[model samples]
Structures are given as structure tokens and as C-alpha cells.
Target: MAEVLRLHGVRKRYGGGASPVVEVLHGIDLTLAAGAFAALVGPSGSGKSTLLNLMGLLEAPSDGEIWLAGEPVHAAPDAARTALRNRYLGFVFQFHHLLPAFSAEENVLMPVLAGRGRLSADDRRRARALLERTGLAAHAHKRPVQLSGGQQQRVAIVRALMNRPRLVLADEPTGNLDTHTAQEVFALLRELNREEGTAFLIVTHDPGLAARCDGQIHLQDGRLIEPDGAGVVTAAATAPLTAQ
Candidate 1:
């Protein structure tokens, strides 16, 4: 399978002031292959969100390289990076950030509209198809306020796929939902992974949820723990190093 994302010695640090620099990720080496559904499991300060932000093009790494869909991004210009981010990456968050004023279908077409200035006929068709797949077809013209939390999240998921991104970065996507709703949303994401072959790197604290993925990446204190053959997280390594 083609690699959808790769990180080479990626590191993240904040504020090089009179105070000591606070580093979040330490020379992280990671890769996500096409269609791979993986969970990023870590404690609160383990740099999971920092790593996901880097991969999703929302933040730059302190001292490493990131390649998304084969495009090197560490040194790209802002415009180029933004273009690549829009074209190759999709994102979901714990809170559904749907536009309150827009209808469900309009919310789903947001990415397409933002990228192309307008939605094409094919784009509209694809949006409806995704809505249908998510069981939101009948609510296409309803605003976000008309939908429940789970339904809003379903709309958010469809919006992420509007541009057909190769990789989706989900940060606690199911965090705000009830158990049943979370399960349904997680199942929907997995279903899309199977049907569309899009790689997903989901940051989750739920061990049960992580176990259901194809593999799990474990992190502690901003470093990835070397996984055994089964991709299960072992003990936290003391060495400040990165390994494949």
C-alpha cells in the first residue's frame, strides 16, 4: 500500500523565550499507509494532539519533516502548504464545527465550495451520496440546530470527505457522544474506511475504541513507544530516540 503520511524525526517545541523551550514531540518517526485505520493512544501530555496537528497541516513541526500524500511539507510556502492541506487532508474534532446557518448538505459541501469557489454538479451528487450513506439524506436541507449531536457529527464526517482526502485526522471524534452514539459514529468511520480506502489516524483515549482499530500507536511524554509485533504499546522507553 502507498504511504498516505510519513513523519521523519518530527519534533515540536513551543516558545524559545527566556524560559526553557517546552518540547512536545521528540523526533517522532511515523507512517500511515493507505486505508490504514489506526488509533493514537496516549496520556494527556503525550503529544498526541501536537502530532495530529502537524499531520493535519494545522501546525508546523519544530525540527523534522512531514510528507503527506508524497508531498514534502516542512519547507513549503504558506500558499502551497494550504493548498496541499486542503487537497490531501481531512479533519474531525470532538466538537462538531458545522456552520449553524447552513443546511446539512451545504455543510457537507463546505470544503468543496471553499476549494473550488463553487460546488460542481458532481460535487453536489457526492455530498448527497455521503449524506445518504450516513442516513442523513432526509435531513439534507435542515440546519445544524435541527439535528441532534450525533447527526451533527455525521454531517461533520461527510464534510471532511467532500474533497476526498487521502488521510483523515480525527481528534477525539467520539468524545462528546453517548456510548451508543459513539459506537455508531465509530462504526460509520470504519465503514467509510473500508468503502473509500482512506487512511485514518484517530486520537482516542478509549482503550476499547483503540483496540478495534487495525493498529495502535502508543505515546508517552511526547515519544512513541516501540511497538511489539502486534502493535501493542509496551513500556515507555527511557531513551530519547525514534524508531519505525
Candidate 2:
């Protein structure tokens, strides 16, 4: 399978001038193949968020390379990085972050509208189709305030897919839902991954959720710890880092 995302020798650090530079991520190396579903699991302060930020193009790495869809984007200019992020990446966070005033369909259309400044008939059709796929067709006209938490999250997921991105980065996507609702949402994500062939890198704290993924990438104090023959490369061999 072609690689959807790759990171080599990636490192991140904070504090430069006055305070001591704190290296959060050490020479990390990882690769996610096309259509793969994986979990990024680690304890608090393990640099999971920092690494995800770099991969999502929200931040730059202090060292090394990030190749998304074969483009070396780590050193790209801000405009280029923004363009690449829109073209190749989608994001879902713990919160739905939907506009309270917009209807479900309109919320799903937000990505296209933001990118193009206007929506076409085709965009509208796609949004409706996604809503239908996720069983939200009836709620298309409902505002976020009118919908339940799970419904709002479903709308957010649909919005992420509006651009048909090659990869989706989900940080604690099901973190706020009840156990049953969380399972349903996760099943929806997995079904979409299989049907759409979009790769997923999900950051989750739920052990069961992580175990359900095709593979898991464990991080500790800012380093990757992988099992042998796990099919992922790391900077160095280390003791297994269990999910918290």
C-alpha cells in the first residue's frame, strides 16, 4: 500500500530564548499506509498532542521531515502548508465545534464554503449524501443547539469528509460521548474508513478503542515504542509503552 503519511526524525521543542528548551518529541519515525486505521495512545504529557499538531500541519517540526501524500511539507511556506492541509488532511476534535446558528447540512458544508468562499450544487449534494450515509438526513435542517451531542458529532464527522481528504486526524473523537454513543460513533468511523478508503490516525485514551484499531502507536515521554514486526519504524528500540 502507498504511504498516506510518513514522519522521519521528527522532533519538537518549546522555549528558546529565556527558558531552557524542552524537547517534547525525540527523533520520531512513523508511517501510515493508505486506508489504514491506527490509534495513537500515550499518557498525559507524552507529546501526543504536539506530534498530532505537526502531522496535521497546525505546527512545524523543529527537525526532520513529514511527507503527506508524497509531499515534504515540514518546510513548506505557510500558504503552501495551509493549502496542503486542506487538500490532504481532515480533522475531528473532542468537541464538535459546530456553528450554533447553522443547520446540520450547512455545518457539513462549512469546509467547502470556507475553502471556496461559496458553495456549488455539487457541494450541496455531497453534504446531503454524507448526512444520509450517517443517518442524519432527517436532521439536516436542525441547528447544533437542536441536536444531541452525538448528532452534533456526526455532523462534524460529515464536515470533515466534505473535502474527501486522504487522511483524517481525530483527537479524542469519542471522548465526550456516553459509552454506547461512543461505540456507535467509532463504528461509524471504521465503516467510513473501509468504505471511503481514507486513512485514520486517531488519538484516544480508551484502551478498548485503541485495541480495536488495526494497529497502535505507543508513545512515552516523547518517544515511540513499538513491538518487533509491528510494521512501523521507530527511532530506537525501547520497552513497550502501554496505553494509559
Q: Which candidate leads the pack in TM-score?
A: 2
What is the model-wide C-alpha lDDT for candidate 2?
0.88
lDDT of 2 at 171: 97
Per-model TM values vs. the true structure = 0.93, 0.94
Positional deviation of residue 22's Cα in model 1 after best superposition, in angstroms: 1.4
Cα error, residue 201 of model 1, in Å, equals 0.8
Cα misplacement distance, residue 99 of candidate 1 (Å): 0.5
lDDT over C-alpha atoms for residue 14 of model 1: 91
Report the lDDT of model 1 for residue 40: 89
lDDT of each: 0.85, 0.88
Name the runs in model 1 displaced over 4 angstroms: 228-244
Cα-based lDDT at residue 188, candidate 2: 95
Q: What lDDT is obtained when candidate 1 is compared to the true structure?
A: 0.85
- Give residue 46's lDDT in candidate 1 (0 to 100): 83
Weakest 10 consecutive residues of candidate 1 by summed lDDT: 228-237
